[model samples]
Target chain A: MRLTYVFIAATMLLVHLSASGQSQEIPSVPLKALTGKHFDTVQFNERENPVILSFWATWCGPCLKELDAINDVYADWQEETGVELYAISTDDSRGIKRVKPLVNGKGWEFEVLLDENQDFQRKMNVVAMPTVLVVYKGKIIYQHTSYVPGSENKLYEKILEYSK
Target chain B: MVKKTGLLFLGLTLISNLSNAQISGSLESTGQRYVDDNKIQLDGEDAEHRYRSNSYLKLDYITGSWSFGVQGESYLPLSLLNYNPELKGVDIGTVYARYSNKKLGLDVTAGHFYEQFGSGLILRSWEDRQLGINNAILGGRVEYAPADALTFTFLGGRQRVGLGFDLSKGTLYGANIEAGLSDILAISTVDISFGLSYVGRYEDYEHRYLNGNNAHLVNSYSGRLSVSKGGFYSEIEYVHKGKDLLMNMGAPLIDGNKKAGNAFLLDLGYARKGLGVNASLRRMENMRFYSQHDLDGNVFNRGVVNYVPALTKQYDYALQNIYVYQAQPQYQTTPKIAAGEIGGQLDLYYKFKKNSALGGKYGTQVALNTSYWGGLDIEGDPETGMYTTKALGFGDKYYNDMAVEVRKKWSKNWSSVFMYLNQHYNRGYIEGKGGMVNATTATAETTYKFGKSQSIRMEGQHQWVKDNFKNWAAATVEYGLDQHWSFYVHDSYNYGLDKIHYYNLGASFSKNSSRVALSYGRQRGGLLCVGGVCRMVTEAAGFTLYVSTSF
Candidate 1:
């Protein structure tokens, strides 16, 4: 009973706090590509097209599942929704080397970016792997964490909703 | 407490008044209840605490280029293992305000923040809650990007010591600049980048040596270059640090002052449609970088400001990870500091053509890899923590590993993976056990799909070692029913000698944006690792729960 009471009180106190996601649509954080090029997320979506930013890593099992699911329908989703996906690898410097080889081996067709320093991950306040966010213009309209096979449908639906 | 409440109130006021503003946050909590068991005691861990919970809650308010946020963490009565004994009770993790303008190409951050420079060799301020570590800078940082091709950053802050802020430990200031040459040169196919960093740590204490008097300043410099074009890539970084005293972690602490720490790292790789190959080399000499100067130099705790991960391969197989490699920070566990280690690794991957005899309908992927590490050759005074070394001289082999793996997609419904590894580990030099360990590990895994939404996977692994638990074997099975529900059961046996069966069972469910998993098991815990940094997890029999969600 005491634990539950504390949880409730803390939740109430925390409900009043808000800042990270609601203020901007797309942050200006710089992410490194596998090819050593840097992609500024702010200027990445030049067309103002709906963007799907997915944060993941090499060692995350659920992330691979989510990416594989998205890959199955990515082309069709792009054709219909005019959306572009950026797979940001949250791997640290030690694991960054696996990015290119793994991506090529799996034949994933998304623009892969490396966050070796975790600067972007920290700025966005991402807490879990396979976190998917739907951004339009500069605002994050929908965000989801974790992964289930059917969850990809929800992401696609959010993309379609924001594309309108 | 008053400060925290004030910041929350200010954030709330801004959100309530601004229709154009937005606020969002996330929550993560893990709870464990321990039960006494004979096996845990046999593993030599004192289970004095019955319950432990670690939780974090964050809130952010943002509008346009301005943002502010606060983070709160609770270790409850005590933490699991009390990784940082001072990390108990409710506390504030970070509070910060930030502003970024894309048009002006400027960013400013004040309060608590995280930053890293050039691979974090010389400077890095960050957090890893799982490791019970958070060394974020508590001060101000400014970033200027006058052009698309060049960027500069300046920051000055005191490192977060233990659970709270300590001013007595002093401050660190750093400057970094990076040039994206490819962006300016308009090189369509080739990319090149260069970076330079300078970090100085200021501690006003009576050194009476090196620079003489108190107020010791340690300066470190790093330069990096990277080139990547399509499938070929190469990158290198070199770091040098000035003379300073530290609580030497590798040896018994008695005022271990070291001088001129340095390191070099290089990576090369190429990948194509069906092939990928990579090679990497690294050498470090007395390269222990820390923000604090008065620690007794014990591993895991004392608030390290930078992360120098073990440069060895990270394995996913349960048995292969047993004899893990930890970076020997200046010849671990000695009275006098000595040479650091040098090592290199090579990886090759090739996929067979589809419809080939071995590939069948889907191609088979074959991967081979090998890695070797050895102590640097050196002759230096140990009492002063000074050393000299030749790169790749290979004084004594500390670790060696070779492995081969094959992955095959047998059919639309089934897939399998097989792997084998051979390793030689110097237990005396690496794990500080005063001996040697030669081991071979083999593993097999398979997954079967049933219908559209169900699947089953199984794994079996075994390790043969001459020392410390002669042999070990484990088997795990997981069943996924529908897309949201999963169940798993596992058992590991030290059949070689201890002959103890460590058993576990768990289940999890995921829907939409949330996931909850609960497991009950006996953790004959030894070393638990993630991303090359490891800590010794205590043995215990417990029920554990993990929960997380995002907005």
Candidate 2:
């Protein structure tokens, strides 16, 4: 039974590889700001520099750690690479109320958006938390999942490489 | 099966010829190999089958205004411990086709899809693999937004019950409208928004109960209002559920055992650059809505139709999670007759400026949170299922938590965090066993960075309790070799009572959009909760492998 699934999965991968070339465009989903306003995700494409999307939640430990690590050096990264980071909170109603205070309390400078129903996360094929993706020219250039302690440094490297 | 595969292949081949099409997917697999140990051992089916694995493969394609996706799940040999038994073997979990036009502000979907209306008080259809919950609706939905400030959604479907496209007997219908009044009024000072939702569950239970008084359809309606001005924001929501027959242990009872449910929730907050304060209060009375009427209050959380998570601070760390709180939104007639729950929580976050007294070299971050919950004060009889609840009152205390945390960066390479928590848990009412427990926990953690990209973090924690698992001590050490590799070891010991040590050591490798982790550990026997929903698992020891990748 397992072998059957493996064969199907391998077949699907082959199809995917055959059809892949151009960088995938960001889905035009509605992103809700903390101040209760909705905007189209395609707006990120208008920026000249690269844009980073970090999917996170309040209950996720590694997500917070990754966000905190990036928050510490966010100003420097922006100054050097002219990149903007958007920390998208995938917290449902269970922890939606905490997003505002937690973001403000930690004094993070990145723009924060709410994916209250996880529509944006699902549309992006993000299965796990702390998934970071760097977008250049409205196309996803680089992406990574599950952050370690020093993963932010690697992400910054990607940002710098793409910003040029 | 062969025909279906061929059709899917044909469809993909036809679509892949398009020059502008895109393909994306994600895969996740978790396998466990149980081994017998002297201190801890697996039991029942888990022990009999030494190897168990669960895997999911999802593929999605997009071109122009059309999109299609399918998810396949496999639980070969067996699923993980505590997963729903109905999910067995390899099968197509969900499939959907959608047509979305941004210019027309219209979206339509057919087949399995997930949706939530306003806080999910009235309706929520989603999938949580860890909880073995995939209640996506299997039907049609249409969403249209006439303007930027207003949107409307209508959906009707049967809830997915299990794998192999097993659907519920009942049908679910929902309609929602959300509007931003500020946008229409052109008011720039404050933002005002409101939403209204309606959800109905139609299940034919007339033949079984023989009670003509009970209706075949159960309806729920919710209204919400939000207004935020400057740094202050507030929101209020209310829901009223139509009367329906109450079930006792998965069986419908006659003799006017029907009851109406309602819920009220409020949130108020003020936030600025370096400080934020928020408070929430909620009251629910018999608000459990199930797609199938008889499946109410099921242990596996199957057939649940709404989302009512416990509005409490979700803490991180091992010791802090032992005394977790689960929302009480169902009628209980076991030890005592109870309606639902009423409670509130408060949170405050503040950051100290750099070079200040509280802030050393880097800024200091402080967070304080507290919450209290109790049963509703109801005057009723369990025989007839009729009750009168006080408009505002606390019947019996259920849970209380108070916690404070402080984080400080000593230098460029060192940072530390300290936390303390106090909890008062009424185990008898919440868990149906054990007495009231009063416990306090304290933890301290520090991280140091060295070399180019190497870092080490150590955490120490201890919990003290007078009753119900007396004392516990836990410690963890994690080392990050570079950007892609990390290793950690954790040990949690219950010294006072069971004297059992739950130890786990693991290493993880992560690259772009992929991660793999391997661990060996003694599993803890308790309620494993995610997003406030919990499942029970027996004590066992095993080697676990997890692999996930996404394109």
lDDT tens digits by residue: candidate 2, B1-551: 53454356446655666566887777899999888788997666667878888988787888889999988788877787778766777778899999999889999999999999889888888888888888899999999998878999999999998886799889999999999999979999999999999999898755456557656898899999999999899999999999977666666665647789999999999999999999999999988889987677877788889999999988888999888889998886767778899999999999998888887678899999999999999886767756789979899999999999998888877888899999999999888899899999999999888999899999999999999999999999999898789999999999999989999999999877789999999988887788877777778898999998777
DockQ of all candidate complexes = 0.35, 0.59
- lDDT (Cα, tens digit) per residue for candidate 2, span A32-100: 999899888988888899999999999997898788888999999999989999999999898999999
RMSD of each: 3.5, 1.8
Task: Write the residue-wise lDDT of candidate 1 on A1-164 in tens digits.
Answer: 54455555455544544333244445567877777666787764455678888999877766866785687578999889789998999888777787787677666778899988787776676877778877777766777766644567667777887775
- lDDT of each candidate versus the true structure: 0.75, 0.87
Compared with the true structure, what per-residue lDDT tens digits does model 1 show for residues B122-206? 8777777788767888999999998877999999998777554543286889999999888888777788899999999887765
Error of 1 at A42 (Å): 3.4
lDDT of 2: 0.87
Interface RMSD (Å) of model 1?
4.1
